[model samples]
Target: MYLEYSSTKKREALKLERGLARVQGPPFHHCYTVSPASQPPMWALRRASVSLTLRSRGFNVGASCVKLAPTCCVEEESGINESREITYGGFLLPKTCFHSGYNSSLNFTVGKRALSSSSTKKEDDLEDGFSELETPASDGNESDNLLTSDAELSDDDGKENVAKEKEKTRRGRVESKLFNEIVNGPGNSVHSALEKWLEEGNELTREEVSLAMLSLRKRKMFGRALQLSEWLESKKEFEFIERDYASRLDLIAKARGLHKAEVYIETIPESCSREVMYRTLLANCVSQNNVKKAEEVFSKMKEFDLPVTVYTCNQLLLLYKRNDKKKIADVLLLMENENIKPSSLTYSILIDTKGQSKDIDGMDQIVDRMKAEGIEPDIKTQAVLARHYISAGLQDKAETLLKEMEGENFKQNRWLCRILLPLYANLGKEDEVGRIWKVCETNPRYEECLSAIEAWGKLNKLDEAEEVFEMMIKKWKLSSKTCSVLLKVYANHKMLMKGKDLIKRMGNSGCRIGPLTWDAIVKLYVQAGEVEKADSVLQKAAQQTQLKPIFSTYLTILEQYAKRGDIHNTEKIFYRMKQAEYPSKPKMYQVLMNAYINAKVPAYGIRDRLRADSVFPNRTLANQLVQVDGFRSNPVSDLLD
Candidate 1:
């Protein structure tokens, strides 16, 4: 046989004695198994190989050209035979072994000739309005960190590294598929999205749900986030951890309201009471600045004999700091009484708290105590120290600490610059502010840009603020917040035309026009005495689905109407804000009530409505009024009683 002769000749030529087995099949079909005794030469590793001559009787050529399986697929009357084979270096393979349909199977590598694997991924993750891969699971995990030196990788090492890359790629594809199927579905509630999908035998794993929840929470889709959390709870699949309940409650409070979240919490079974839900509640209370409610919550925890961690105490400390900051001492005293040792977090908040006041000696003593307790301060601690130093008029000390932080490889960021820029701007040291701003411009983060804009805007340096805006646009696409800030700057400079054009540009660029943008535009119209234009903005905002204005925009209109003695429009705007679910504050109602009183237009109706709503007149509403009206004096200070 030609096969026998060829096998014998190959063994003789390469000195590789391989055992060859021949099987009987159709005359045209030849199957042979060759077991190599040793590694073959690189030239012998061929795949999808055949030994039959091109002149075989079973084969036919079209257009007088050879149409082998490698060159073309043979369409037969029987089941279509697709190529399911690969060719190594001139190696022979049986015809029937891989004469089936196509499948992406494994391919072994020869020396230096690496084959690329082709895999497909979904478009949902990469499409517009979604880039879930921007926050890839292994993003910023550099392979260089895992390497010891610039040494050449061995065969095994190369394969392993390739495997890891492929694994990450495959994981991204899976997550994209899962997200498109579940998260982006038309189901309003989490139950409708995932429950049916699982019941239909589709894979909806616990880890996948957890990842989806994290992404939703990060994206601030708290309504969908709450739904996912509730769905996860209903499934009773994974054991809910402390953070699970805490995060779910937090989302409920954020997406819905505190009362609704509290109602949801009360439904938690008594058996699931081990984790501290009170801690999350304290954090929310702190954000709300409800001193009385926070105190009551803490006291109730004491009455309930609930165990308090250092984190819980830290939340109470931040809450106290926002209110009567002097009460921060009471938090420390409470910690001491309860034998709760201060963590790094405790000291971090304390350092910031102490820094806010002219307590240089107090800060020194706290640092001494931290050292005494064997706690090395972190970057935040150092940053807080710099804040305290600058506040205490110790500029040199602040600069020296900044250098020390840099030496420690604490990367220069917006937080450090924000603390320094304001101090320099306050001291009228525009040079120092410029120098620090230059450093921040190199980073060009959104928050740091706001800080830079604030510095330039406060100085009334129109040219410099515009320069920063231009730089922000060049470095990255302008965000909604950036556009709003630019509009404010334009307003300050009396460049209303440019601001209007910028709003148009934002809309054209598919950016959501937020409440802030409308607020700025309305203020511009109000300043120009274009009352009808301002009203048009309000009407357009009410109708817009994407750019639906928040309560603040409506408040601006109400305040304007109040200033103009238009009680009818004031009441209508107030009602609209309430109907649109814009989270009405008592301050909003109080101002409108005062407007009614000033206009002498049945003030008792508004007053009685306020009383029935339990709206206690706010004292700090004048600050917002000052911002909008550009007033140096509190016009509505007489609104209280």
Candidate 2:
């Protein structure tokens, strides 16, 4: 027993019939729709005994019992087109009911409409049974119109529709197949899966390959990203552009080292080796705080006669801001001589540098200069200003600037909410933090939620922070960043057991515990007075991830050891940091010297060590050295005995 219906309507009807079959307690037989080429010959006969009870909207449509040793094929005479067939409770409608045109005398609609009627209770029950299926709500007239339209569609239109659907499915499958294979493949290397994809005769477009590379980079799978980049370049299917070369160069630097990246840059054609390529290398250098190498890259850019832009100058300013503030004036002079105007980032760097140096007057002068040049501060600039103001102990100024940043419509400028939450919390303005959080609560973004958690934590509202974290995990997958925020809160309040439980959850959930999570975990154990445990976690992290644990991870343990006057462990950790190739900074030396001072037993080779590391002592450090040298005459080591 078969019922004829269009493909779209057939899907809905099949779902409804399955539900009815389950309720009627019968073994449901599988049904297949006959295509045009497979239709039975006209006038053929078959022996069958079939019984069908048709029901719609809980109303009985009567029953039909038929036994035929010779059943005539009346499909052609009934005027039925090549529509598909579905079996419903072994029921077959009369031959005349299969007419292409609607039969008003039958008083029953076919397809989804057959299950839907004017009775709201029946409709509700049907919906409840098949809630996953989505069918449009329509009255009897609309359903009739829909069926008529389906029947009236020309054969050419049907073929075109199917072809369009097939093409869409093919395109989506092709675009995501390579990416999925690479991500879910067994090993770290994507080379094998990528090669397999090509061998499988799947077409690769430049857009598809480029998108895969971009996504890999975002995931920080630099090794896989570099492999994909190298594979694509080796195939030579697409001509290399400047940006493409630059992307590969950046990948090489990240996966390998900057020196290897430099070697690769030399292999690039001069046509592709333009300023953008050099700037890419320069940016990577600056990010690593490799001042000497970065300057060399800058010189190479000049030697190539590439026109220097404000972007390159800003990078130099940023580098100088972090290491060697004296070089900042030199970069500014170069920018002035080259007639390159300062960008917003350039001004912001200068402002931050001034603020860090505690030169409030200098920061105001930069802002004045920015205004004079007809450039208004952007949101980032305003946030930087507000932060410095708060740090300078000027709450009124920070509040005024924050209000201006909020502007006329706080809701419209939703981004400002994340920025303001922390600043308000830092100023101890609980009400302002609550107000900002309320606006975000309506439709919070991921980053805004993280900021709210951190802000609530800073305000010592553990319950509120836990509530937000709980709500967030239910909506989104638990990311390490989110977990790190709550962990930091627990660490600050010295909740060791809570931090340990979160770590266990992170492992069980397979969250990617990267450097940030490592930093937070280290801080957690350190704050809990388990310095030995903190040191062990750092060692384990170095072995686990390809990426190095961030500098702060080591520094946290070192600082704790320094406070305890554990000179041996302090020197050991400091040497480990140097072995990690972290650039020497004055703060590291100051902390090491503090360990000696706390132990009251320093008198040997401190000056030589500082000079060997190329770190100059500040006035305070100079005074400390003199005090430590005073220990030489007294010989505190002998005093300890």
Candidate 3:
């Protein structure tokens, strides 16, 4: 509500004017003046004074209050313009509704005294026309006269009309109850009904429907919401509501996530401050993994108002760390300019980002910056820097940092051990690795050290790797993960024989064979041309894994036999392949043909090659024919010709 200035009035006068309006009704209700509940009392009083003057001239003043639902469209005089409405309760006074009601001719043109005089005549005839009326109020009370005259003018079915009004109010309340249950209650059936309502675009208000839609979106029932939105779009009612509805149609864009909903964000009103918009956009961006957009929104947010919350700044810093170091520097500069105090996350982000770039000097600069700002780098920041040093092969620096952390009562975190152990092993710093392990002895980071032990074996530092594994198994009494790690390392380095021996050692130690263990053994046997041994390994692997042999597992043996030109062996493996029912490629038939030809079985070989060419006609197998031990009329050549 807008108010005209009164230079002479004191605060006391304003309070008195408000008191008069509450009892007597607003004077300017006919002119569409409004007094919103949130309006300062002082402003309300001034509006009341103007309103009092209009009412004194016989304008009818009816108090109207609107309680909006969460999502609604603001009413527009012209059908084309639409504004989004936020639902709020308590007091809502709009200027236009007042104008329509108070500016009625009988309200403005006829004086109260004329209406009161006519009410006396109507009361006299009440017995004839309105027998339901018992008695009218005594004549001396002008308030009662006003009430009676108003009732009489509407023709004396006052009791019945009041009852009807009460019924309507009851029905409105009931509808609101049903709507609340469907949208907010725990029942799935109610939720489904609301979804159906949204789909139909029926007589329900947009605010209630949109509220339910957003709730469904939050719950990740996007498919249902999209189906409803699409149905709503086909309706005549929702078509002109807002084109941005399509933008808000992210409910169905399962793959796009929040990235798709972002288009609708800009449609929010310009009247909203940059701070509000940025917060909303930032949240949406981070939720959808759009780190770049999160950065852009954060940058925009700072241009308007530097975020002061620990959460917002931390999130922005995290994004910077994950992406660009330059952005971290930019954020630091912005932080100082905005007079925003840097938190631990700010320092951690700068350090981690710099470390990722391997800019040791940059990381040193961050430390110096933190000291200058009187902010201590926390354990996380130190861990990041320590890890960077280890990656750069600065063992002395990393070790010194870890020792310093210990002296300061900061136990070296498990994550740092995970990183440093592998790094030391790769650099072959066995002594440094042992020292870290001893430090971990008193801590809970022993398992993390296991990963590093495996990394040593992978780098072919087998003696050191075996030493670490023995220590973990004998001293730590840990699980078979240590053995598993060793197994992987051997297999990765193509030391399949070593892996098989390790599997046998594991079995001897009462560690029954894991399938991975058997797979390693089978690979070794097959590579060593021990087909019978490989088949035995496969059987053992199946018994250990409990699950049926995967196709690749059987294919592995068949492929080896076919490649070796061992036709007898390939024929024996074919029984297993048929039982497995694994899909065979043209390559398999070609390999079979090669094996047949190698066995001096040309008839079988040529027949298989022809079948291969028919099924697959490209590359090696797909060629017209192989001119092997030149026969004048090659079967494959004949088929191609």
The candidate maximizing lDDT is 2
lDDT of 2 by residue, 77-121 (tens): 000110111101111112211222221111123333232111222
lDDT of each: 0.48, 0.59, 0.43
1 or 3: which has the higher TM-score?
1
- Mind giving the per-residue lDDT tens digits that candidate 1 earns over 1-641? 00112344333522321111132111112242332212121111111011111211123222222222211000000001110011011111111111111211111111122222111111001111101110111112221111111111111101112222334456352333444444546645557777677877887676777666654543445677777777777778777865577677778776676677677778665664523565566556554445445555554454455655555555555554333332343344334334456655455554554455444544554554455455666554665687568767888887777667556432333345654565556455688778778776655554466667767876777778778887877665556657777777676666778878988888887665656667677777776677668878868876874334644556667777887768888888888866765433455665575565557554534434644543432333322233334223454764642
lDDT of 3 by residue, 337-444 (tens): 234454544555545544554546545655654555556654445655776788777878987776665454324343345545655565566776666666665533
- How large an RMSD does model 1 have? 32.9
lDDT accuracy of residue 266 in candidate 3: 63
Deviation of model 3 at 63, angstroms: 77
Clashes of each: 9, 0, 4
Native-referenced Cα lDDT, model 1? 0.48
The candidate that wins on TM-score is 2
- Estimate the overall C-alpha local distance difference test score of candidate 2: 0.59
Q: List clashing residue pairs in candidate 3.
A: 27-51, 27-52, 28-51, 71-207
Candidate 3 regions with alpha-carbon error over 4 angstroms: 1-289, 292-310, 408-420, 423-427, 438-446, 449-455, 458-641
TM-score for each predicted model, relative to the true structure: 0.51, 0.68, 0.32
